[model samples]
Target: MDHISREVDRTQELAGVMSKIEMNHRAFCFANVKDAKFPLVGGLYNSLERFGDALGHNGPEPFTHADFDGRIEAAKAEPIQPLTVDSGLTKENVITGDAINLHDLPVPTFFELDSGPFITGAIGVTRDPGSGELNIGIYRTLIIDRNHFVINASSMSDLRRIYSSWEATGETMPIAIALGVPPAMLIGGSCKLPPNMCEFGVAGALAGEPIQLVKCEDSDLLAPADAEIVIEGTVNFSNRVENLLGEFAGQYGPEDAPVTQVNTITHRNDAMFYSIVAGRHPEHNTLGNVAVYGVQRSIAASIREVAPEVIDLEVLLEPAMGTLAHVVVSIDKHSDAQPRDIIERIFAASGNIFPVSKITKRIIVVDDDIDVHDPVDVRWAVWNRAATETKFMVIPGIESWELERAAKAGQKSVRIGIDATMDLEDIDKLLRPIIPGIDEINLEDYLD
Candidate 1:
């Protein structure tokens, strides 16, 4: 990991450093910040390639479709058991009530238009009041006061379901925000896995060992034992503060949000405070991309069961119109009618697959030759394969998980799809010439 000296200002320095590291595809931590009690760190999952490396794709090469599929399957199958430890590093330093000050943690205000400093990297852990099923997710927590913060969870998120259940029964929901957890936990928290799958278990699988957990002092909920900081809090059923929460999309989230009353703060003796620049940043986009890939792979597998022609799918989260708004699917087309049928099946699978079915507003289907992950290749396919009128179709009045859309239109949206696949019957006439043996050539040995 790379370390930045305390000479750089904490307010905007970390964002600049993270962007550079992302471009260079390196992992690093900012070890010091001026006047801050703890060191700040970012860019742990700065690139998809780095995430691929963690999943055993360690070579200095991009992850292929097989590598990605293998990693996802491993994470799904090897569910590591979480061990409840007697005590851990998270419990080393404890502060409660009068001594608690949220501002002392060096939470930086990322953008000029942001409402306030936010705890962007914490994994908010909540459980169902009736079933006791645990749900851990990365939610935006806006610091409202010294001891209070607002949690902004999307409508489709499991956290909202748990919150709603508590509200129905008139009970305050106990929660624990785990910060500075291992990279596996962060990636796991952002992933959109099956409803029954626990993120802690997935994190453990990613880490190649069981994750250690410790019960919070105020709540029965457990936080990551290795985390730098753990904030024990409660979300009251009736005590909510309305504010425009900051989002990773560089806009204010919904005005109404549930308030978290911080009861206690526990951390390691020499803890490093972890934070991320939320608005349109690489770290935020990377988390979104991770979520997209998990959902994409799962949904694609489910779709393949019905439509066997489906090869792969890519959710274009980064450098797309909006995060999780567009998807590109590849299929081995046999007939002219197959593309439209696949699109219908994808839309029908909305009941089973999450995030993809909820957040995606557009989809484009292409042939196997068009690499969906490569924007240039996909754009080329779109230009050569699709006709404006015949290839495109729009479906209106769909469900949306995005807060901005839900707030305005009551959680409804319109979706569009593009058929960018070539007709098999005309393939002989339309086949393009290929430069043979190019794939086997080593460009560095020949030129650079």
Candidate 2:
């Protein structure tokens, strides 16, 4: 959580040029990266342990998965209001008229196959005209020109919903892209909170303080008062451009993205642009993982309400899977049929428990001994516990996202679930191998 306000040459147009800096900084947790004319903030949420540290919970002992989940769940309960300020640091340098240019910013082309430079960390802020509720989410943008940029409006997002309404009424949706805010604010933007809730409020709850905000000069939108940079613009629904956009999964897929026309660009006098290179990188994947995990927390809570035996749940860490393609759950089994019952209930709770169930294709169930967050433990349970032929079950003819489409059967997809837990009857008799007193050994005392 270190901040450095300095300057560096940003004329380098090569893609992934700054990714080396993010990679190097990740080697050391919370390392200060002051690269280019503006300081490139890297290593933010590079790992789950570092993410816990950034959230101000860096105790003497490393945080466990449950510790991380508890903090996120607590924030959802009581959200704090953001403070309104007359002016913000972002307005210290405002550019308008013909001088507005995207090249001036250190927009890095992360991968070699990317079509052009992209703004990976910019959180697009848009408001629903009908309800006036503000929605903030991260949408990768391509710099097409000085004032024109193509925004990826794919996925079932609140921002996309607002844009659809604007398109229906033949109106342009006003949007403000905020970059380089506090860590909490950036993480808040990545979550898909309730439609009525604002990410600014969530950020305030995480920080345990009200986030300072200032009204944009051109629009009725509010932005972080201390953000490094903010770009205000309007997106035309009718005028669109189709491009093989580069995704975080390292694929160039065609998306008819909405085009945004920049109206004003604002930043601080010593603005440091924060860039996250897209691909299967931790910096990019970790953002979605943390946000999606918050939603999974709520989903797990709902599942526990119906079935109290469910102990822990986690969305697998695969960037190509788009954060929700796979899920792992640990439960205190009571009956032989509990595993299949848990999977059925979870799948049926789609849209209610999971806002986007299409992103999940596989769900695995394990006993309470297995740590759902630990891949090694989960794999071990899967290999040793499940009855390979009979425990595996599949449900077909389900809705799916385009990225995971396997057949030309419209939106239909298949889901698989494996009962990786031991048989209920054998649980009491069979015992897992373990060394005596191993758990009592203090690692710190032994290593030092």
> Model 1, which residues run further than 4 Å from truth?
1-36, 49-69, 243-252, 309-315, 325-338, 341-345, 354-358, 365-377, 403-412, 421-429, 434-448
Worst 10 residues of 1 by lDDT: 316-325
Among all windows of ten consecutive residues in candidate 2, which has the lowest summed lDDT?
A: 27-36
Top-scoring candidate (lDDT): 1
Clashes of 1: 1
Model 2 residue 431 CA deviation (Å) reads 5.4
Instruction: Judge candidate 2 at residue 432 and give its lDDT.
Output: 85
Q: Show pairs that collide, candidate 2.
A: 7-37, 8-36, 8-37, 8-38, 9-37, 15-109, 16-109
Expressed as tens digits, the lDDT of each residue in 23-53 for candidate 2 is 6545211112223334455556666677677
Candidate 1, residue 379: the lDDT equals 89
Model 1 accuracy (lDDT, Cα): 0.75
